[model samples]
Target: MKWLLLSTLAVLLALAIAEGEVWEEDDHEVLIRSERGAKNQECRYAKGAWTECDSKTNQRSRMLTLKKGNATNCEPTKTMQKKCKKACRYEKGAWAECNPQGQMTRTDKIKAGSDSSCEQKREITKKCKTKMAKPTKGKKAARRNRN
Candidate 1:
């Protein structure tokens, strides 16, 4: 008798599956429901190309769209973000006194929290005007003697 009952249940389950009906089992009960409008299937998304990095935010973003035939409960579109590979930042020092070549120079060092790819130090140089001192009286006498 038990064998006959089990075989009947198995046949019913097979028929339910073939008819687009799902069987859900709980601790104390078995439920049968139709697959139409059900949110049982996993969501699927089509990913879009990543956007250019934003310099101010140091981040990049991409769009995710739900693929065709996905469940209605799934979100249609979403956005995702990631940190961008950023260049290093530098802090410039004050310009030094002008040299004999009428040029001034300054140093730049990587600032705190700068990207690791940046160089540690940089040097900059530019032309400058040099100050002149007045000639002494002894220098004038020497010129007179030479003449």
Candidate 2:
């Protein structure tokens, strides 16, 4: 049963990746907050052709979005055929795996030409850690051999 579950997940993940490109992969250890769209789509040249796709907005979301972008302007040629992936969106878009440091790492698989960031995570983590951590006395440690 465990193996079956793992294999199913693996297949779904592969399909998701092939559907589009991952813009950012960040696995961190802190809380994160950001305002972004539910889904991101892009166009790419693959296998001597072009493909237009958008990642799944979240888990439990299926159906790879295609030709939803500026594909009409792109107008790939016959030789530059687009891949009718004949696939579904498994689990795409922003997903995360946090570490033990109370950090929530984020991974984003968005279309190309998209710019997004997690601004609040940085500010919040810094403030929280500063408030909770104890001050250290004595000389600060260095990562080298002092003369």
Off by over 4 Å in 2: 21-147
| lDDT per residue as tens, model 2, 33-68 | 111222333332222212343334222211222323
In angstroms, how far off is 119's CA in candidate 2? 54
TM-score of 2: 0.17
Q: Write the per-residue lDDT of candidate 1 for residues 23-136, one digit (tens) a residue.
A: 443343333345644655534456677898887898999776666434555557766576787677889999999988989999999999887667899899999965677666
Stretches off by above 4 angstroms in model 1 are 1-86, 129-147
Scanning candidate 1 in windows of ten residues, the lowest lDDT window is: 24-33
Query: Every model's Cα RMSD, please?
Result: 26.3, 19.9
TM-score leader: 1
Which pairs of residues collide in model 1? none
Give the best candidate by lDDT.
Answer: 1
